[model samples]
Target: MRSPTARTAPPTRTPLATGWGTRVLVVLAAGGVAVLVLPLVALLAATPWRDLPALVADPAVLQALRLSLLTAGSATLVALVLGVPLAWLLARDDLRGAWLLRALVTVPLVLPPVVGGVALLLLLGRRGLLGSSLDAWFGLTVPFTSVAVVLAQVFVALPFLVLSVEGALRGADRRRALVAQTLGASPAYVLRRVTLPAVAPGVAAGAALCFTRALGEFGATVTFAGSFPGTTRTMPLAVYLAMDSAPEQAVAMSVLLLGLSVAVLVVMRGRWVGGLPGARPPRSGQDAR
Candidate 1:
């Protein structure tokens, strides 16, 4: 009898779709990233390094920075107050015309900033519809004022916050909220304790984005608020003005703004990666005891 030898099966090789199309996609993606990076590289290379300190410390830059911070902060606060509830309603409630409502609220995101400024002007200018009444009743002028900057920022930034919060609400576990409700927790209490905590990460991310957008607001703020130094001129408006007379200073301003934008992204990266507050880790059966 011939000795039987065990025959081993050869390992099966899986074929991957690494074709020409894939190569083309990879090349295109790299090219696209390079295009985006080149501008910043050029900007940094051309920046006035020696005069940066004096340029940034100039009164104009300081004023613009102060105004930008004030307006952006105010806008963020306004967005939180109005947007959080709106987002909650949009995400959880079965309201009629919700889609239409969302579309209307988000119109500013797509609309040109200049157009939005004009729209705000028509709605709140001295002789505007409600504006005329306000002036008549209380002499409260809105446009061409500091308040106008905040309003413009809020108009442009609200959608970012609302969308963020709504996404968080949608992704949250509603079972805990329901359980709270069943345990006789008031709606308000549950919202304050359970709902807000669950969506806190989105809220934080949204606030940062909103503040960033408000800080960079240019067109609407210029149109509706008018760029008056120490009154309504923001950092971006300062940049525009400085570009004509002080190109180097403008570059400095740009660098600061760029740094701020980068910082916001760096800070919010963790939230985007799902490291949310109040989110509990899964427990093993033995650990649960």
Candidate 2:
């Protein structure tokens, strides 16, 4: 037994690289996160807690909150209905101009919200080319209305939804989808029963992002919708209106916005991790769907 043990080789240990580059990257990442967190910390520290309750309870504040929730929710719904299909197409189809289409979709993300509002006005205002006929035939004026707010929010929010869903669809195993089809599932059935379930987490994350974007939308909402109290005014508009009259109220609203943003980030982070890169495949032979 001693001879056999002596003849056996020793166990090997793996070495990890701990170079200066790695240290620099780690320090930079930590600094980046700290920079992002400092502003929220300051906002909370500066908040006048004694007046926050009354400030938030103001009728105007309530109206803005309600309108913000309504319009943001509606815009998210619109994004979901339209974006899912667009995402699916971009992910699965072999269209010739797919790259160009994707680029166009993200244009609103880079364009200033105010510019988006002006573009909306030029296309949909009462005197606009289409708007003239729309007003003449149906007496519909989209601008300066709650509808305008929803449109502007939708325009800005749709890209987030599409990109998220498209990413999910692309990461999915299409070969598994083909196997499902060979097992007698129609394309629609496969999509509804297979693909949808696999990518649902991404969809949820996307909807959360769209809602957050819509909730914070300001320039387009103000420029196109005109910030009428109890109608077009949302939280951002309320904050702006409060800036001149009640700085404390504005700060409170900003804090609330910040809180909502944090909540969305938390929820989305959980869903995104559980869904995509960190997600494990189904343990059994059955597919994820």
Candidate 3:
């Protein structure tokens, strides 16, 4: 054929470097996932399946479990009632020393739970400053009571709810809420109708976290609540008690607590992971781009 047709060059790849980079990232991610997953797997594998029913049915275990749920639930409710308003104030108000107040609010987060318990005892114990007045006037004692258990858990967990809700409130568009208010909606109406919907996921996440933290509250409960069975004792208390005479029992209780913790985390992940699509990710790397 007369004139040779021009030869076409093969399409070139984007680059081998890009492919290698992706491979390295995937491998690193896989390793990180493995590191986190293996411990949970080991705990499940080591669980005493045969003894689970017996351990669960044990009266002491049952009592502790019941108390744990009751106190943790109560604490979460308390946090919701008090912490939500506090979060609103932190986010929306222009109060003086607001930053200082926020720092104070999170003090419990850094303070040791045992230290928190001791502080509570100092402020609310039988011989405590207010405790003395409470005893003299009302003949009331908080230490070693079921109420004390709830109080301890709330003290340690309230900050989690407050901080979560406050962050959510801050991130949400205030303009939308203001628009609702300008459209003849009352402040309360705008908050209930416009603001709360935007922050529901954060509230859910905070509650889940508070519940989990309260469930595992051992140091404070032991120090202030005294681990009284059917009264102040909770799942963590049961585990500690079982550690001495029945090591198997201790391990069994540990497995139970572990399971409960994992369940809470799973529920939190499912409920809050992608619930607020408009909300920003906690870290820059989490951004989808």
Predicted model with the maximum TM-score: 1
Q: TM-scores, in order shown?
A: 0.88, 0.86, 0.82
* lDDT agreement of model 1 with the native: 0.88
Error of 2 at 113 (Å): 0.9
* lDDT tens per residue, model 2, 1-289: 4875575454345665699998899899999999998887888998989998998888888889999999999999999999999999888676789999999999999999999999999888989878888999999999999999999999999998898888888887788789999999999999998998989888887888889999999998888899899889999999998999999999999988888877887968757654543455554433333
Candidate scoring better on lDDT of 1 and 3: 1
lDDT of each: 0.88, 0.87, 0.85
Q: Candidate 2, TM-score vs. the true structure?
A: 0.86
Which pairs in model 2 have colliding backbones?
A: none
For model 1, how big is the CA root-mean-square deviation?
7.5
- Candidate ranking under lDDT, highest first, comes to 1, 2, 3
| Per-residue lDDT of model 1, residues 1-289, tens digit only | 5457965454455675698998999899999999999999988987999989998999879999998999999999999999999988888677888899889988999999999999999999889988999999999999989999999999999998898888888889899999999999999999999999987878987898899999999999999999998999999999999889989998999999999988987988767434233344334444333
Error of 1 at 14 (Å): 13
User: Weakest 10 consecutive residues, lDDT, candidate 3?
Assistant: 280-289
